[model samples]
Target: MKKFTQYVFCITILLSCKKIGTPELQPINLKISTVYASTELGKKLSLSKVLIKILNVNTNVEKQLITDANGNVSFQGISAGVYDISATITIPAATYSSVTGEIVDKDVIFNASDKNKTIGLTNNELNIKLVSGNIGNWLIKQIYYAGSNTTTGAGYRDQFIEIYNNTDSVMYADSLYFAEIIGRQSYTNTSYYTLPNGQMDWSKSLNMPSNIDANNNYVYPRALFMLPGKGKEHPVLPGASIVIAQTAINHKSPFTGTDGKTITVRDPSLTIDLSGADFEAYYAPFLPRPLTSDIDNPSIPNLNVLAYNGTDMLFDNPGRTAFIIFKRDGTEVKDYPKYNYPTISTPSSTSDKFYQIPNSVIIDAVEIQPNTASDRVPKKLGASLDAGYTFAPNGQYSSQSVIRKTDRTENGRKILKDTNNSTEDFDYFSLANPRGFK
Candidate 1:
């Protein structure tokens, strides 16, 4: 009886041991989804494929499951209890068409699990816009001032003009001039100045600024003066002429008319009425002189003047001088000599010395009302400093912030989370680690 009872106890112990040795099973579920996509122009997107990874903590083993076409994916039958779970997606170099498509990369991280728990994600469709050109459709439009009514005196007034160049090609308009008319000559003697037609100016002589941009035009009010004995010093005189001439005409021409040695003004519009006393011309407001053309009648409003002092016709520096001294109307504000030479000097020269130069006389300072809103305009600080500079590709990465810390060893990281290209200055991580490139 004792032997039989012992045998039954041994069998019971063995059954208990077998039960204790059995392994416990835990289940876990994982799911992944794309949350956002890239849409701005010049961006590279890779949010198409998604994957979820299930890992065994004790055995250091992992399994992967791919998501659906819409970046929707799931993982089931994962061991529970703080398992090391990860997710991954590869962004293949997107197949693109010329009509419009995506160019995806071969590798990029799409998504990952958070806190080793079943995480839910909603993938957002990425709409990436591509560009064939930089600064597309943006042209070098006209130059302009803030507005009118900001003009001060000769140097204080704010005035600017527009030069529109819509094409990508570079452009240049040099030797331009601007001026008002003083008076017209009698039919016989063409020596006297004539009235201006349609945006016309004195074309016989011009003093163009040195540095002008080819692509972009500029506008600014400037004090102007003619070369020694070139044109009339009194603009706005009854029937006066304003012209814009090339620098080659700086020297006097010996062309004679019915009267005597009368100058011949050419016109591009082919409207030259040689018999008429006045003609047309085109001159920018800030230019120092004008070109000669045919002038039937000018419709541009003549600038009105309130006061003019003949003695002080230029600034103390003498680099700039008023060639014509008169009010807006036919009346002469101050009678300047028929001609006066202007002296040019550097900044080191004293104002008094510059005005007293030999052979080159300086005009006195004149007070004119403000013409435009340029006085209140601020100078662009950034444009002048870094006019031509760009960033290096390798160094550009330093400027960006990393949104996702990927595990390369796990082979479970999403491929969309990687960027191996240079980023545009304005690009940012607004979507699921997607970048823009054009």
Candidate 2:
């Protein structure tokens, strides 16, 4: 019994002597700041927003804090450790191309204290340069599908940006860098092919015996050519920039080719006649049936435009005027006259069918007298009719008789009239140009 009592006493003593430890919490305080580009004496750099990233080395966790408009940021109650803090300054879009673009990137490090205190960092601005003017020449022509029209067609579309020797004389190909800017990266597609040494093959530069207007010297000029439907070809989205070299604008030509300074890169802004030459586009309009549908689905009647880029594409919707033809059954219809323009209506949406007009039919011309004061051309071309519509009987549709005067800014940055309406009540149709270059 005495031995049992002694064992219980030892156990009690052991329990009473137990030790518990409390962890010591060390609170941390940090402050971060950023600077912008400056050029004046003691000029303080400003930032739209600043971000500070504090990293804890032991746990490998990060804590982020954002600065106010005054370029001040702070972090509190942080875990105590040797933290590495970096600052980032953000520039707004309006200032992005202006002042912020000129700034270069700079980084700085800071340490947080165990107590609250003001910590300032400097020169955390990112270096950038503003691209004020246009960079390159090569303007993209048509990016179309090799076969049919589908969103996937964008992937299969053969892309080409036609480079113009806007400069009178021919330039060297070696001095130029032809490329597409996709995001932050620039892609180059320069060829060693001698460009515009003024040489041409017989079949390449030959003009038809009867037609003199379509005759040209070069065959495939210094244009960026890519095979459509090929895996991972040139892919472009809206607002993508295409660049060309101003110095190396010209290319070399093979032997016996015309080295004359007569090579002209066609401007897509001009009116390309379907019957005239300079039309080389790859299209497969006729596909075997059992396919899903044509280029557009759920198309609207009296509407025929594929894409709109402020007149960049043939179907530019200045006011979202771009439309596709649709039957009453919600299917796309591509028949001529099924979709045109200058459609008629009763000012109400209930009207079933209205007469329409095409957007490209030419009407008349007015002669202007020669005047030294004005550098105007001798004649001004008029539209076939205006852009309004007229009412007609049930069987007879309204005709686009008057000219529709709508302003359009062409590739040349010139405002041209959308002159195609004649009677305002006629059949609507898309322009029948195979190559969508013009």
lDDT of 2 by residue, 363-428 (tens): 111111111112111111111112111111111111101111213333543222221221111222
RMSD of each: 31.5, 28.3
For candidate 1, report its TM-score: 0.21
TM-score of each: 0.21, 0.20
| Tens digits of lDDT, candidate 1, 38-117 | 34321444344444454443444667666565555556644444333333433443433221264432333233332222
What TM-score does model 2 achieve against the real structure?
Answer: 0.20
RMSD of 1: 31.5
**Ten-residue segment with the worst summed lDDT in candidate 1?**
380-389
Model 1 spans > 4 angstroms off: 1-7, 13-23, 26-48, 70-82, 90-109, 115-438
